[model samples]
Target: MANSIFIPLHAVPSGLNEIIDLIAFGFSDVGRSVPNVYSAKSSDADENWKDNFVFVEDVGSGERCWVSFFETTPDVTGNKEWTWLAGVTARWSWDFAGVVAYALCSYADSIVYNDSGVLTGQEEYSAKDLKGILSRD
Candidate 1:
């Protein structure tokens, strides 16, 4: 079984394409190359229009991870919200997993959200925090 974690993202300011690119760049910055990355969106009319997902494969070890983003109804504050579901397969080692987690946290921290037509705070996540989250299961 693969070890995985789901991160809830609130008020994501960027679109799916931009997020995907950001994650890819994050991985590259850490020297953990991802040779293949792919994305797809659901075409079924019955499904929510926000349904989209991405898959990333490590260049050297062939380990794989995936991310899925979906929008949720606004809260009482009426701010746009979303969820970021991400995971890595068991094929990855603890060190590699930590590296990936760091990359993810870095990407999350880089996101700047717009609130009430103004760019406000940035997303927050620490690599150490993410590593602790990923170490379970």
Candidate 2:
């Protein structure tokens, strides 16, 4: 029932490549399959959450999540389907909050400060802080 988590990034470690690599590494660290990440073409926008690291958990849940990045600001466009952090955005459409949260933290240097708990009334989460959060269903 929780929606999204926002990881505020100072700057992408290197570029889009690092974002893809760290997310893959982070997912592996969280026990999910390392996902294939690619770029979305501006010429042919699908209007779906594509062109980023995406994966579906096949262990029964089949929950889906996608990552979207922005420089100046994120175009929210009144999309309530996503939970937002601050720097980078990771959206879990159904559940798997801990997995997405863990991956974002991995990107922002193993620890991140977020104000994304508007729906959950939680705040200030870190990578080491996610052990309990990730333990839940």
Poorest 10 consecutive residues by lDDT, candidate 2: 77-86
Q: lDDT tens string, model 1, 11-85?
A: 342554555566666555655554465656543232332455556666778766665545544452233543433
Off by over 4 Å in 1: 11-16, 42-50, 71-100, 110-125, 128-137
Clashing pairs in 1: none
Which predicted model would earn the best TM-score? 2
**Clashes per candidate (backbone, < 3 Å):** 0, 3
TM-score of each: 0.51, 0.53
TM-score: model 1 vs. ground truth: 0.51
In candidate 2, list every pair of residues with a backbone clash: 4-83, 6-85, 8-87
Instruction: For residues 1-137, write the lDDT of model 2, one tens digit per residue.
Output: 43455665545344445555776666667566655554453332233333343332434555555555444333441223223333433354323545555676766554444456532356666676664555433
Question: lDDT per model, in order?
Answer: 0.46, 0.49
